[model samples]
Target: MPATRRSSLAIAAALLAVAANTAPALAASAPAVPNAPMIPSGSAPHLVGPHGEILHSSSSNWSGYATTGAKFTSVSASWVQPTATCDGNDSYSSFWVGLDGDGSDSVEQTGTEVDCSEGSPLYSSWYEMYPAYPVNFNDAVRPGDHFTASVTAGDGGSFTLKLSDTTQGWSHTVKKTLSNAALASAEIIAEAPSDASGPLPLTNFGTVDFTGAKVNDKPLGSFNPDNITMATNGSTLATTSPITDSKDFSVSWKRSS
Candidate 1:
């Protein structure tokens, strides 16, 4: 649909947030089903973050799905962008995660229309999602310190990531898992696009196989698949929304707890 980004630190905060506010007993209760929602019917496919024992997904402001196929004891939504068609009605390739059983719950949850069209930037909007719980992370990272690829999804999909920082800006290593194969190995290559060069392709995370999986799993703006790192200099990291506009969408950086 559009460019969306989530970091390990951000996911950590979400899990920690959930742990801090949730009742111990409730958090411990075993999930009866996989929480991953079905594919959302958007201009394209998109991904939803994972929740404990559940996957979250939604399409527009009306329908949501839970896979119930794969269950986790404790989960934080996370995954790498896929390589597939990334243009009109093709930008979003797939999405997983659940919404409240009641349709239209996301609108109230985030206070914005679930439908997001390109060129439509929402300054600040809230999609109130009824996730099993909020997944927050711990506050342990500092500027300048970093690592490379910390693992996203390992099932059939896996990715290698990297982080870079400088007085000028920051960049995340880019690598991706092939449709049906885990990205055996990937190295981030910095190739910024100039006015002449078209959008730079994300650094190759390595290649495995892709027979039936969608070619472009993620759209261009929805994420920095180009492997461009974020700069924290001068610009305040927009961890929380600070303005009001016409968009409200949230992504989960998943990790199993």
Candidate 2:
């Protein structure tokens, strides 16, 4: 895969500029998904293996998984949305479960975002089929709400993404088709999305815990595992929160870059 365009630092920045023009503004009271691509952007540095599999990432993000040799047909995780600190900057971050795009052209992902704009925080749910942009659902999400997200590959290049807010008793599911999917990696991540300027400043959301993580029906630890932290400009941006078992772990917000 040779660190395809999606993971390239230069290309990610270029795409951000193009996509930013179409990105939507934060909605008031109701969460809306911005038109951000789910690929790695320049602001967050990520390491890739010889074949292009993601090894680790730094800065406003963390990716947790074991390299399953791309055979993963599905991935899932559950987390509680963290309260985010808004400092009047247009900062953003997301917690998602995805397959591919770490080392492949396609990523099928679903998650929730906590974003700060104009001194306030916006909460929303979304699903993305990458290369394409993310689509926001109208589901109401609040800090501390329990959410579960998953994506499964179907026959003939089809995928089904599902999101559930157990705390709020709301759920949404969608099925879509995407050709050229590499299916080369699966990840559970907390990320900073990109905008015209760059990766939008990361929101100062506290620790986000992801539990019941599984790939191909196997627990996260069964594959090997990479614990990631985000760092920028020689400063730590995020750290892996403590976990009692492989099935669950956390990514804590350090300081925004």
Best-fitting candidate, scored by lDDT: 2
Q: At residue 255, what lDDT does model 1 achieve?
A: 11
Q: Estimate each model's TM-score.
A: 0.18, 0.79
What would the per-residue lDDT of candidate 1 be over residues 186-248, giving only the tens digit for each residue? 111111111111121111211111111110132111221111111122221111111112112
lDDT values for all models = 0.20, 0.69
Model 2 quality (TM-score): 0.79
User: What tens-digit string does per-residue lDDT give for candidate 2 at 1-257?
Assistant: 12112333443353344234333333312223332323332455556766665555543334344344747789998999888888866567888998886556567889988777556667778888865767778656788899999999988999999999999898988999988787777778888765434454678988888999988888876665555666656667677754457678888887777
Poorly placed runs, candidate 2 (over 4 Å) = 1-63, 66-68
* Residue 180 in model 2: lDDT: 77
